[model samples]
Target chain A: MGDISTEQLAEECLAIVTENAGKKKIKAGDLQKAMAAKYGDQVDRKDVKAAIKELIDSGKCVYGYFGGSSIELPHVEGSAND
Target chain B: MADDLKIPLLEELEKGPWPSFVSDIKSVADRKPMAADLLRQLEKSYEDKRGYWKHGGLVGVMGYGGGVIGRYSALPEDFPGVSHFHTVRVNQPSGWFYTTDALREIVDIWDEHGSGLFNMHGSTGDMVLLGTRTEELEPTFRALTEKGWDLGGSGSDMRTPSCCVGPARCQNACYDTMDMTYQLTQNYQDELHRPMFNYKFKMKMSGCPNDCTAAIARSDMAVIGIWKDDIKVNQEEFAKYLDDGFNVQEFVVEKCPTRCITVEGKEINIDNSNCVKCMHCINRMPKALAVGDDKGFAINIGAKAPIVEGALFGSVIVPFMKIEDGDYEELYDFIDRMWEFWDEHGTARERIGEFIERVSLATFLEGIEMEPSPKMVKAPRDNPYIFYEEYFAEEDEGEGEGEE
Candidate 1:
């Protein structure tokens, strides 16, 4: 198993972002679809959720919990958050 | 002259050989009455030696808030022409070489929604459509966007990159600078259109060392073409130069700073060991000397006017990086890496160069996964010693040999 590349992660992240483009809130399922699209049948939903958590930790992605839905990838400061 | 009764001399002195912009403004003043009135105020202020315009304002055309820049005025009714004179900077095609139809479409659109007057190109290399009303901004932007056109930088954003005529017209080009410029522009439309950074960013590309675009002095990020191999000299071409009354001794051999060339009869032998690759000799003898086969590129940073820091000329960062197929994937990744690092640490209004200087180049390079070279010095400064210093100092000992 090779180390997870940022390019692969970014591609998955972009897909997730596009699906939830206009939505006020997103969910963990969005990340699963993103990961599925990239790794096909290999990526598990749990791993996808973990990647989102990593993005949040790196300050590259943000999230919010509202109305029982987790809105991942909120705007980061000093970046094109909007 | 009374306060309001004086004609401006600066306005009258517009007719001159020194490339006066006042004359250019006056040409449009007649067609547009409002423009004429604005010019009168401008001239009056010039005569009074006072600034006619204030800096900050909100001026935009209708529809989109992002598309139209909003510039308001303290006295809107008085200076009607300039009060809400919002300019729309349309991202121009790379190299600014547009087909007849593309140009016609843009002009037609501008004529319909905004003022007929155009600035041709703006400071950020965009087509500047001046004097549009705030109400028409969104509609105009939508119309342009529908036609596959887009707005360029105005405030703090990534500005459109510009390049000189490369393989399109010049034979000396090593890469398609124009195409690369367009690709970079298109790929980063979000950065170009949106205000994401602290201050405006500028990028420029040039075909070769001729520097036809003046990228070295003007842009914050400059991509210049270079060749890594030694100079190619044609003996036959050297003979032609000599036959044409060119002084081989005085002009060619003696003029070489490194004493790299030795002209013996028709044969001009070059010592590759001593050559500095300055391109001075190639410039002098174009036909005889050519650039090497192993072509590459160099990256430069921090070239801009004095603002937060003193003016800086670009210093070479990547001394000699291979430009494989001119695809520049590595270059693109490098840019992404730079943005990731800078965007994280940079404050509002901080340029990449300023950030690098503040944090130190070593740290910046480490973040970007690049190594620092000896060429990457602090900054360009004048060296006190000249070439003959050592020779002159040792002349008393009589240890050196004379010219053979």
Candidate 2:
């Protein structure tokens, strides 16, 4: 609710992705929507995009398109069991 | 193998005055197995009265998702030259304009990398480098890209946007169609390279709707230049035409699609609102009339071949729109919204036309927030009296249900 730093925004984004890691890759739009739902437009789309860019560039996360326009992380090969 | 040759029947094709394709095939048949097999296949097709090959496969380049198409021979062993035959697309220059040096450079690249065979331009407006081996693709693309050339789209993406020569060479052009096309291509590079759509998306433009590009039938998004105001009529020219044995009533008034034009003695009158601006009269009598002051484009949508639905010509969506400030944000936004709707709801391989059919036109229009207008109707309705809602309402009231 308060003025959040880019680091905090990135961590929150990473939390969303990590929480739903096996279900689906994190969509930046969806993450922005979640942020807006919680923070009520206090967090801008630019902020969310910057957070995702940082997450990808930080090498802490892998960015890939599984399908569609929403950039989803590739499902880690050995991480999932059929 | 020459004993089983069908050269005489093939030669029979060359007996005509015009040059035959079989002659070209035969000239290279001795050295190229592909050419020989092509001739043999033609002869066999003539003999058997059927095609010899089927098509399917996913052959393309790495990293990129489009701009290459896979082709293979059903009988690979017999026609080995065309076995791994794949078509490479080099993004053509605007209006297909190129200097002599540029052409030679392209041909030189193709000679070194491909089978030295090429199609000047494919239907999608790419300089098609035909019959290239799969192994030669990366280097070929590298060489082409080094020459300031890149690939056009091929599979499941926004295939290259092309336009007619606007303002550059033609007098009828209302806007800078070439620049618009170039801007769109430059801006949508990611869309061009990706396979994100349910199927391929095409965008094409025409200057003044003579439609030299044939965008209406071939493109998903067709931008055709249009005029909103009355046509400028040259009275002197009209009088001269009448004096020179040209019947104004026979040629201009009678041929008007809307019956909006009329001739009284020497004076010609037009009902501007009823005029569809089909350019028929203008074309027939170019010297007598000219386009109006207010000119823009009529954006049409959803033209495609039959896949899930029947083949459809593009329908007018926006009757006229001004492409101002060298910015097409409105068009881009509309396309984005439409893409979002299609991306979310469309089935795999279903084009936007089929999607519009699957979900009624009303729903599709609602999704894109476009209002239906009278101009939307491409032709007169069979029964102009019946509204869709009225008919549906009557049907819902069980008018025919119990009787049936």
Candidate 3:
């Protein structure tokens, strides 16, 4: 799989975020690390960041800088739990 | 004996060659007491070196968030007539077309409810009815809206979309610029009335690369009509042009950006693909040369007034895309994506051009799913061959190695 397209990375990112949901805000850095570990050298950091932006922009997830260093998904009002 | 009311510093404004705003106001000041007081307060401010007016807390009408900018002067107790002079923006008709009856009706309404004065058309293409009281805003809005007038945008929302007169009047028009502008304005009412972003957004359209609206410099996003094919040249017209004072070598041939036009004895040949379609030839020889058949728009991004930074013209993002059926879903999606990214990340008072400057053009292109093209590159790159991100992908691939 040639770097698992940005669309695919976005899906993987969402799944990772969902699993980490309700525990705490999913850290952007941690999410990048997890994707890197899973995909090896197929994906670059910029592509991962772009994927994360796509996820947030698409409303599949919400993003905000948590504690100023890392961006995390914020809770939405009407979304079903988990 | 008006010297008693005049401040000497203001008289200096009238001494210049050009017509003075001070003098114009003075003419109106005789009949309008508020205008007299406005001049008085302005003179006092120049003397005192202070602002005579102040902005109040957010004031708006029922079910609306924008289109009214509330202003109240601190000198209300002294100049009561000029106290609550708020600005109300009424959306203008497409291509600024207005019948005499419509014009008279608006003027009559303004005369009844507002200060009789109105800006024929504001810079944002709105009919700016200046100097009205807070109490009169709703009734004025009601009267106008009842007669099918709506408000233009203000605050942090999308400002009114403006366009040049297109196929209706001009021959150079490649697309229906007026209809495009009207369609965008009508479809995006929510974006106009609702102040949801960090700053204002504006869209402007021009029928052709002539850019009558100056959309590239004045708007946040511009859809300038363009053609992808060769320039249409008329041989018969070319001969007449040659008979006249038309110097094909001095004006048209030399001015061609790509040196695409060749003029031999009684014959002119153009390399169609090499032509940049800059309209230099078309403008120089109006009868001889014309625009091509295959037409569309070149979408651009990041134009704005100099606020947080210097004024910047929007750069070409997509060189050409056909705008069919007057449908602009692609353009709208591009706008939405851009707004989503900017609204989430932009700082207060930073225009899109300034924001793009902070974030490299590469990031914006990536975010918008647009691959960088030669048209999007404004200046010559240090390495002429290395174009877009793909060129550096191999170099980026070397990044995941562990430390030695």
Top model by lDDT, which number? 3
On residues A1-82, what C-alpha lDDT tens digit does candidate 3 reach at each position?
Answer: 3457889998988888888766655544566678879988888666776776677557676433222122234443221111
Worst 10 residues of 1 chain A by lDDT: A73-82
Q: Candidate 1, residues B43-140: lDDT per residue as tens digits?
A: 65666777554432233322111234444333456666665555788888777888899888887887676655677777557788765665667777
True contacts kept of each: 0.00, 0.02, 0.00
**DockQ ranking, high to low:** 2, 1, 3
In candidate 3, stretches whose alpha carbon ends up further than 4 angstroms from where it belongs are: A1-82, B1-31, B379-404
Worst 10 residues of 3 chain B by lDDT: B379-388
Q: Candidate 3 on B93-135: residue-level lDDT in tens?
A: 8788889999998988987887666786888889988777777
Report, to 2 decimal places, the DockQ of model 1: 0.04
Please, what are the lDDT tens digits per residue for candidate 2 over residues B1-404? Answer: 23344666777988979988667656655655555666676676777777655332334444455677756565566556666667888888778888999999988997787766677789989899876666778888888889898999876688899889887887677677898899889988867875557678988888886778888887888888777667889988888899999977887788777788988788788877577777878887888887777777777778886655677777776666677788789778878888878866777667887788789878888998876655465521121111133234454345321111
Which scores greater on DockQ, model 1 or model 2? 2
Chain A TM-score relative to the true structure, per candidate: 0.57, 0.77, 0.76
Q: Given the true complex, what DockQ would model 2 score?
A: 0.06
Docking class of predicted structure 3: incorrect
* 1 versus 2: better lDDT goes to: 2
Give lDDT for model 2: 0.70
TM-score for the A chain of candidate 1: 0.57
